[model samples]
Target chain A: MPKPLLALGCEGSANKLGLGVVSHDPTTNKTTILSNVRHTFNSPPGTGFLPKDTAKHHRTFFTRIAHEALSTAGISPSDLSCICYTRGPGMGAPLSSVAIAARTLSLLWDKPLVGVNHCVGHIEMGRVITGADNPVVLYVSGGNTQVIAYAEQRYRIFGETLDIAVGNCIDRFARTLGIPNDPFPGYNVEQLAKKGGSVLLDLPYAVKGMDCSFSGILAAADLLAAQMREQDRILSAEGGKLKEGEVRITPEDLCFTLQETVYAMLVEITERAMAHVGSKQVLVVGGVGCNERLQEMMGSMAKDRGGSVYSTDERFCIDNGIMIALAGLLAYETGFRTPLEDSTCTQRFRTDEVHIKWRDD
Target chain B: MTASTGSQDFPCVLTLDVPFPTARLASIALQSLQVDKELSALVRRTFSISSSIEGARGDSDKILKVEYKATTNRMLRVAFNSFMESLNLVVEVMEELDADVLSTPIAA
Candidate 1:
C-alpha cells in the first residue's frame, strides 16, 4: 500500500493550543481531518498575562497533542510529510512557543516546516470544511472580528469592529453579570439565552456603515445592568417582593438581545462586504462563528443576497491545529518555508501584511 | 522635556542634521532598524515598512529617520538587521525614542 501523506497543524494563539492531523486525499484535491486536540492554558500569575508563560503552554500542549494526534491517526513521524504551526497575529509568547517547538520537530523528524498565518488558517479551515469557494468571510473571535475577502494577492478587510471584537464584548458583558469565564462562559451565556424568556429590554444599537461600534453597545449593556440593580434595591425598599423576572433583565433576555444585535451588526457588514466583492457565498469562521445565532443570521443574509452561507462545525470553528497544518501544506507547496535561521516568533502579524502567494491545490 | 523653542506654527520642535547621503542612509537605516528583532519580540511580530526617507548633511551619506510600529513581536529587528547587513549597511546605536509612554520603541 502507498504511504499516506500525514500533515499536522498546530495552533496556540490565545488560550488554546490546538493540534490537527490530516491526510491529503489526492482524488478529491481536498484534505481530510483525522484528529484534533485543544489544550488550554493556566492563566499566568502576577500580571494576569505573561508571554513566556503562555509560550510554555503552547509548547506543552503542542507536544502532547501532536503525539496523541499522530497516534490517533495511526501514523508515525516517518509518515508525516510536513509540520505546520501558527505563525502570527497572536500573543508573542504563545506564537513563539509553537514556532520553536515546530521548528524543533521538523528538524528532528527531518520534515519540512511550514509557517502558517493564524488568521488565514482560520479562514482556510472554514473554507475547507464548508467547501465554499471564493466566499466572503466573517471571522469573529476574542482577538479579532472582520469581514474579509481575498483579492489582488491579499485578504482585504472589508469592515471590522472599531475597537475590540464581538467575543471580547460578550466576555465583558458576561463579567458585568458576574458570570464565570471558566469552561467557556460564552457557551453558558448562549445556553442561558435559550432558557430565559424575552423581557424586551431596550438598548442602544450603534452600527455605522459597514463598520461596528462595540464600545457604545458595551456601555449600554453595562449601564442597563447597573440600572436594573438600582431598580431592584428600590423595589425591595418599597416593601415589594421583586419577582425573579421582574426588575431584572434575565440572563437569557440579555443574551437573546445581545446576540440579536451583535449578529445583526455582523450580518449587515458581511452582506455589504459580499456585495462589495460581488461574491455570493459566505464563510463564517472563528470562535464566535460557532454561535448558532450568528450562523442563522448569516444564512438569512445570504438568502437575501441569493447566495448561501457555510460554517464549519465546532472543531474547525475554534482555533485548532489542523487548519494550520493545511495552510502550512499549501504554503510549503508554494515555497513559503522559513529558513531555520530566519525562523522567529511574534505576537502580532496582520493578515494583510502577508502576500498570499500560496494556495490549496 | 518641554519644547525649547515653542512656535504655534510648528506646535512641536525637532532637529535633523546629517550629511546628504548619510542623512538619506540614516532615514533608510532607521526604517530598516525599526523592525529589528528586539523590538519585534517586544511588540510581538514582524512589521512591514511604514515609511523611509533620505536627506542632506554635507557630503557624507546619512540616512534619516524611518518610522514604523509592528503589531506584534516577530523578531523583525533581527530580520531587518540581517537584511541591512546583507546590503552592507552597518547600523550604529542612535537615540531610541519611547512610544508615547514608558515603553521604548524598539529600533534595531
Candidate 2:
C-alpha cells in the first residue's frame, strides 16, 4: 500500500484567515481533515474591510493559527509533505500576506509549496465533503458568484455575476441597516429576515441569460432603506409608530425582500446551467453557500428536474484552509510543485486556467 | 539603532528594529508593512522579521527590521513618518484583536 500524504494549508484571500491540515491516502482514495481553524476580521457596522486592514489581520493571526492547526492535527512541521496556500482571485493585500507566510514556512521546513486556485479549492472541497461525483456547482461568496461544471480538464464557468457579488450585496445592505458584523453581516441579515412577513418590496430582478447583476438591485434597495430612514425620523418626531398605509418598510422587510430576489436570480442561473450540462446533481459552495434559503431554492429547482442538490454547512461552505489543502494535495500527488520564485499570488485567477489533472471524465 | 549616512549613490538610510512578543507577531508586522507602495521615486524601503536565537532557548522573541533609503534627509523623514503611522495601526490591531485576544468559539 502507498503511504498517506499530509498537507498543511493557509488561506487569507479575504477578511478571514484560516489554517488547516488534510491527509489523503492513495491506496483507498480517502481524504481526512485533521484540523481547520479560522479567524475573521469583522469591520464595524457601516464600513467594509479594506485591503490593507484585512492584510494586517491575516498577518497578525497567520502564525498563531498555523501553530494551532499543527498542534490540533498532532503533527509537527516535518510530518507534512507540502505547504499549500490560496494564490488568488481575491484582494491583493490579503493574498500576498498569506503567501508570504507560506513561503516562509516552506523555507523553514524545506517543504515544497503548492499554490492552489481559490475557486477550485472550494469546488474540490465541496466534492470531497458531499461525496458528489459530478455536479453543476453554484459558488456564491463575498468576492465571487458563479455556476461551474467540469469538462475536458477544466471547471468551466457557465454563469456568473455581472456586477458586485451576491454576498457583497447582502453585506452592503446590512451596513445600510447598521447591522452587527460579529457573526457576519449576511447571517445577521438572514436572522432579521425571519422577522419579516413576506412583504416583498419592488426590487429589480436582473438575470441576463446565464449571468446576473446585483448592483442595480443594491441601488434600489439602498434608496428604499434611505426613504424608510427619513420617514422613521419624521414619524418618531411626531410621537407615533408607522401609521396605516404610509409605505412602512422595516430593515427586516428589506432584508427579506433582498434575500428572496437574489436567491431567485441565483436559482434561475443555476438551473439554466444544470439543464445546459444535462446534469442531475447540483453542488453549492463558497461563503454565501451557507444560506439555507439558497439551498432550499436550489433544492426545489433540482427536485423539479428529478435531480438532487448537495451543499455543506458553514464549516465547508465558507472560505477555509482545508479546501486549499485538499486541492493542493491533489495537485501535489500529480507531480506539481510551485517553485519559490514562481509562487507569487495574484489578484485575479480564473478557475478554468487550472489544468484538472486529478480527475478523468 | 543608528542611521546609515548616505553615500553619493544612495543619500540617506534609516533602520528600525521593532520588537514583538513572538516570531509570528513580528512576521505579521513585517508582511503588513511590506505591502506599502513606494510613494516617492527618491525613497526605497525593505522590511524583514528576525527571531532571536534566545527563542530557540525558550524566550520566543522576535523583531521586525525595516530599512529605508532616500535621496535626501527630508524625503527619508517624510516617508519614514508615513510608514510609522501604518506600522502603529498594524501593531495596535495585532495587540488588541489578534486571535489570541479574541478567542471566540469557531462557529462551525
Candidate 3:
C-alpha cells in the first residue's frame, strides 16, 4: 500500500489566522482531520478590522498556533508531505503574513509549497465534509458573494453580488446597532433577527437575473435603523407611548427584514443556477453559511425542488486552515507545487481564475 | 523619520541590515520579504544580500540589507515600521519551525 500523505495548511486571509493538519490516504480516498486551530481579530464595536492591525494579529499568533496545531496532531515537520497556504482572494497584508510563514516552513523542512485559492478551499472542504457530489455552491462571506457550479474544470460563477457582499451588509448593520464584534457581527445579527419577525419592515430587494445588489438594501436598512432609534427616543420622551398616528419600530424587526430580503435574493439566484446547471444538490460554504436562518431558508428552497441543502457547522463552514490543507493536498496530489518565485498574493483573485484538476467532472 | 536633515524633499532615509544564522536562511528571508511591493508611492525601498567576508563561501552571504527612502520622516517611519513587523515574523517562524529547532545534545 502506498503511504498516506500528511499536509500542514496555513490560512491568514483576513481577520482569522488558522492552522491545521490533515491526513489523506491515496488508496481509500479517505481524509482525516488531524488538528485545526484558529485565532480571530475583532476590532471595536463600530469599527471594521483594518488590514495592518489584522496582519499584526496574525503575525503575533501564527507561531504559537502552528506549534499547537502540530503538537495537537502529534506530528512534526518531517511527517508532513507539503506546506499549503492561502494564496489570494483576500486582504493582501494578512495573506502575505501567512504566506511568509508558509514559505519559511517549506524551506526549513525541505517541503514543497502549494498555494490554494480561498474560494476553492471553501468549496473543496464543503464537499469533503458534507459528502456532496457536484453540488451548486453558494459562497457567502464578508469579502465575496457568489453562486458557483462546476464545469470544465472550473468553479464557474453563475451569480454574484454587484456591490457589497451580503455578509458585509449584515456586519455593517450590526455595527450601526453598536453590536460588539466579540465573536462576529453576523452571528450577533442572526441572534437578534431570531427575536424579530413580529413586524416585517419594508426593505429593498435587489435581485437582477443571476446577479444581485446589496448596497441599496444596506442603505435602506440603515435608514430604517435610524428611524427605529428616533422612534425609541420619541417614545422615551413621551412616557413610553408613541403618537396616535405613528407606528412603533424596533431594531429586531429591521434585522429580521434584512435577513429575509437578502436571503431570498440569494436563494432566487441559487435556484436559477441550479436550473441552469441541472444540479439538485446545494452546498453552502463560507462564514455566513453558519447562520441557522440562512440554512433553514436554503433548506426549504432546496426541498421544494426535490433536493437538499448541505452545510457544515462553524468549524468547517467558517474561514479555516483545514479547507486550505485539503484543497492544497488535492492539488499537490495532482503534481501542483507553487514555485517560491511565483508565490505571490493578490487582493482580487476571482473564483474562475483557478482550474480544478482534482475533480474529473 | 525623525532623523530627517530637512535638506530637500524626500530627505528622510533609513537602511536596515537583518542578519541570519546561515546564508540560505538569509536568502530565504530576502525572497519571502521582497515579494510584497511597498504600498506607498512616497516610500522607495530596495533589498539586497551582502556579507562582510570577501567572496565568502557556503555561509558568507549572511546579511539581508534593506534600504528605505521616503518623502518625509513620517513616511519613512510608517514604511520601515511595517517592514520590521514582517521581518520580526520571519525570524520568529525560523526559530519555531526551522530544522535546527529540535537539535538534541549529543552525549558521550
True interface contacts reproduced, per candidate? 0.00, 0.00, 0.72
Maximum-DockQ candidate: 3
Better of 1 and 2 by DockQ: 2
Greater TM-score among 2 and 3 belongs to: 3
State the lDDT at A39 in candidate 3: 94
Model 2: residue B92 alpha-carbon error in angstroms: 16
The residue-by-residue lDDT of candidate 2 on A224-287, one tens digit each, is 9998998888777857666677778888899999999999999999998988999989999999
Cα lDDT, model 1, residue B61: 40
Model 2 C-alpha lDDT per residue in residues B1-108, reported as the tens digit of each score: 459886675679998878887787776666545644675899988887666533455455487778889998899998887677567656655544344443543455
lDDT of 1 by residue, A240-343 (tens): 66567655656677777777888888988898898888999999999889888788889988998899999987788888888888777766656677655555
- The C-alpha TM-scores of every prediction are 0.72, 0.83, 0.94
Residue-pair clashes per candidate: 46, 1, 2
Candidate ranking under DockQ, highest first, comes to 3, 2, 1
User: Candidates' lDDT values, in order?
Assistant: 0.67, 0.87, 0.89
In model 3, where do residues sit more than 4 Å from their true spots? A238-240, B1-12, B53-59, B102-108
Give the C-alpha miss distance for residue A326 in model 3, angstroms: 0.9
Pairing residues by index, what is the TM-score of model 1? 0.72
Considering only N, C-alpha and C atoms within 3 Å, which residue pairs clash in candidate 3?
B1-B73, B10-B71
- Tens-digit lDDT track of model 3 for A1-361: 7887999999999898999999988679899999999999999998899998999999999999998898799887899999999998999989998998888888778899999999999999999999998999999999899999999899999999999999999989898999888799999888889999998888988999899999999999899888888887877784677768765777778889999999999999999999998889999999999999999999999999999999999999889999999999999998999998788788889999998998887
Per-residue lDDT, model 3, residue A41, is 98
